[model samples]
Target: MNRDEVIAATRQWIEKAVIGLNLCPFAKSVYVKNQVRIVVSEAKHVDAFLEDLDRELEFLAAADPQDVDTTLLVHPTLFPDFLDFNEIAGIAEEAVVEHELEGILQVASFHPRFQFEDTAEDDIANFTNRSPFPTLHLLREDSIERAVAAYPEAESIYERNIETMTKLGLDGWKALGIPGMGGEKK
Candidate 1:
């Protein structure tokens, strides 16, 4: 897919799964406010990808939260293997520290095949983190703090997400029409 198509698919997943399912209670607010920034990376190699990541991290750190509260750095074809994408997540964390945005910004990972530790590859719970492509979500620490403070029982989000995904099931996820989640081998 081209860059625009990648972004469109990502937006659809955010709207249908993340917001529509209420998977992330904190997502809807910034999303509806148009504070979510989505960037599609065309980097063809790991080094270039990290460069893209570094640029995004800096941009997000300097951007006004009112204008861009969070960013989704989506890469469609770079890390097709989930394990490689998972490793990139560790590198992404290091990038946050290298940029000296440790306390200011953080990175959360999402992939088409995001398997939680010890969870089977096809476990429904993994669907909670699954997205149309491998994405590194950049978030502001202060925003997370405020959201947590205002949210009651904020700790239950993971369990709630698991429950939501389980209820939705693989069939339900496919019905959402997200690319790469059709329950067929790619």
Candidate 2:
């Protein structure tokens, strides 16, 4: 997919699955307010991707909360394997510390094949972090703290999301038409 198509698919996934399924209670507010910035990276190499991530991390750190609460840096074709993407995700976290924004910013990851440790590849719970493409979510620490404070029992969100996806099932997920989930292979 082209950059525009990739972005559109990501937004659709955010809307139809993230918000529609209430996978993330904190997502809807920023998303509806247009504070969520989705950037599709064309970086083909790991070095280029890290550069993109650095730029985005700086951008998000400097951006105002009302203007940009979070950023999703997506790469359509890089890191097809979950393990490689997972390693890159670790590097992203290191980048946060390298930039000296460790306390102010955090990196979250999502991929089409996002599988948690010890979980089956197709476990419904993994869908919680699954996205159309490989994505690095840059979020403000202050925003997260505030959101967590306002949200009662924020710890339950994960379990709730798992339950939600379990009920949705693969067929239900497929029915949502999320990009990259068109087959039964994943």
Q: What TM-score against the true fold does each predicted structure earn?
A: 0.98, 0.97
Question: Per-residue lDDT tens digits of candidate 1, residues 34-139?
Answer: 9999999999899999999999999999999999999999999999899999999999999999999999999999998888999998999988998999999999
| Residue-by-residue lDDT tens digits, candidate 2, 45-76 | 99999999999999998888899999999999
- Predicted candidate 2, C-alpha RMSD: 1.1
Output the number of the lDDT-best candidate: 1
Identify the runs in model 1 with alpha carbons over 4 angstroms from their true place.
Answer: none
lDDT of 1 at 164: 90
Ten consecutive residues with minimal summed lDDT in candidate 2?
A: 177-186
Considering summed lDDT, which 10 consecutive residues are worst modelled in model 1? Answer: 177-186
Whole-model lDDT values for every prediction: 0.93, 0.91
User: How far off is residue 131 in model 1, in Å?
Assistant: 0.4
How well does candidate 2 score on lDDT at residue 137?
93
